[model samples]
Target: MVSMFRAASVAFFCVLSFAAAIAQPVKPSATTQGFHSRARLIGGGQQGEHWLAGVEITLDQGFKTYWRTPGDSGLPPRFDWSGSENVASTEIRWPAPKRHEDAAGVAYVYGKQAVIPILVKPKDPAKPVRLALALEYGVCKDICIPANADLSLDLNGADSERNAIEAALVKVPLPQALAAPADLSILSVAPLAGDKPAFTVTIRAPVGTKPALFPEGPENWFFSASHPVDGDHFILTVEEKPKDASGPVSLRLTLVAGDKAIETEVSLDASDLPR
Candidate 1:
């Protein structure tokens, strides 16, 4: 079993709450949006062993944004920090995402607004770190629109926004060891009959529980909708194993039932499935 924690890749986190985990940058940078965004930094501008940097994004009413795993269709958020100076690296800490269902389709997005906390590490502890962010994200309602923001911050000392940053950080999912809850278990995994080749995930959960299985891993992997088999069981149709696959592909599954959710990772191989 592997931890579901996904380190920040490149600049920002599109995953549930990676933005709060390791999103690189220093200080609090915010700018007025010309379109549907007004993003700025909160509780930053400090030099420490690790700075708790955060971004607060507000969208126009009725507009929604996407999560790291957008389920069937949606755009994930992206960040670029190439414009920064005296920066070592950053990671995005993600909070659990909400499941959204609308006429367009099912999408994973934040509620009305999101306060994403990022963990930043500076190259030189003595000099102030400068952070520049070029953020690209999508907001949708009846139609989808792509938006961008240019925000930068200079870190010298801590701002007085710690309450908000600390609050948002609490929503981030913590690393959990693999466990088989008494009421639910993943039964089996195998390839399905298809020309393109896809696999099926079978699981058994207590009756009447609304079960949802979400896939998290490689960007190329695509997971389909979950199909109910019975009150005690269901199945997930996932992307086909690449025929030219070299090594095993690592994947994670989030099982949400009622208010409780379990996050676990396993390789999509026969050996990894439960007997």
Candidate 2:
């Protein structure tokens, strides 16, 4: 079930408030429009030394956006924050993406809406920070389109949208062990002996729970989306590799099951073929 297609090329183009004391609507930054979607910047006030923020994207029904690593095809969303003031650095924490298949290929994406949580570090803690974002992403349904938006927001320690940002943050896959839990976890990942490079991943989860796995490797190495082979076993095929990619490979695997997800890094040596 390894589906492969020519990668689609994307060209660049192009939330929220607190109560009246609790009933007031959470107001996001000015909205920027794109194809069939809208984007804005959200603030979660200040959390410790870092400022909590988000880039929220809302799309029309049946539309979807790509993840940081857009599996087989589709362009991953790009973020630029160089337009900000008093912002030293920012880290975009990605939520666990679901598997999306279309005529084009298999991609990891978010459907209908995506709230991408960002952690901003200020250059000076005592001063206010202005966060800016220039985002370019791909939206797809029957056809794919490139979309862009520019959004900005000044953080003044407002907690209007803190809950929303925190909710999205909970979806971010945290680093975990291969066998993190007894009910849901990856059992093993071993190289498959074949002309083309491949690996088989075994996962464990409660019965009837469908687990999805996404594998990411070093630059120049393209690992296809994990294809479920049998009960709890999935196959990851390597579609392309650099000429010099013949050494032990390190892969970041994100496995999602039900409401639980984990990101684990595994090292695979070509010589460790399954018997």
Candidate 3:
């Protein structure tokens, strides 16, 4: 009887401890799910037919979010506002990305904060516009967690916060003439044997400026690291198309040269490619 009693006591404590652990809530990491963000209009000139707005995301220290193109791996944010009023289109612009590696692998990130500048155009420019946005994005620290928020705003006047949005907009890359002094252009594109056709692309920029190349396309397509050659040149290995890719694929390019940059795009027919 004594031995049996002792055994029951031990078992009871073990079960109790297990229950306590299982009932404990998960500790929130540097970035947690259902992250916070708000939609606001930054009224200023040069907005033209569209108004400038943003979904401002701020996470705790040590956390990070991804650029429009998250590079090798990471979740790029998505915005769906079809349910909005007087809404015609929403263009989310991205600033330059910071390159780094974590346990998850190499990723391009916007650390701790991301104010995704949105160009909102009204279906009828004469009518007042209201925006309702559904945003889905990823945040990372020790582990990656997907976050979401729904935001809405009415276009009105500029806020004191307008400066921050303007600053972020300034970081948006501008298009340049292929031969422009600050521009970087693709010199050649060659294919490599793969289940999903890949390519080796070469780019040239101004002399003496260290440059990095980022290739963006469908989610399945992946880009490799930049390899340097002699004379303001570099080579990039990229998955030019996604798996079983059928139609034409558009590949966007961003070149980071010192503190300046440029953007361009290339179209390749996936169904038919010779050499």
Best by TM-score: 2
List the candidates ranked by lDDT, beginning with the highest.
Answer: 2, 3, 1
Residues forming the 10-long window of minimal summed lDDT in candidate 1:
1-10
Summed over model 2, clashes come to 11
lDDT of candidate 2 over 213-247, digit per residue (tens): 88898887778755566768888877776655455
lDDT of 3: 0.64
- Candidate number with the higher TM-score (1 or 2): 2
Segments of candidate 2 deviating more than 4 angstroms: 1-29, 270-275
RMSD, each candidate, Å?
8.6, 7.8, 11.8
lDDT of the candidates, in the order given = 0.63, 0.78, 0.64
What is the TM-score of each predicted model, taking all chains together? 0.71, 0.87, 0.70
Alpha carbon lDDT at 123, candidate 1: 88
- Candidate 3 local lDDT, 1-275, one digit each (tens): 32343355446545543554455354322122354322233433227788777767777788788788766555677777875788788888888777767554567888876676778888888887777765666667765555555566667655555677788887777775444443466565666565544566667766677767777776565556554566445444553334476677777777776666677777767677432
Report the number of the highest-lDDT candidate. 2
Better structure of 1 and 3 per lDDT: 3
In terms of lDDT, which candidate is stronger, 1 or 2?
2
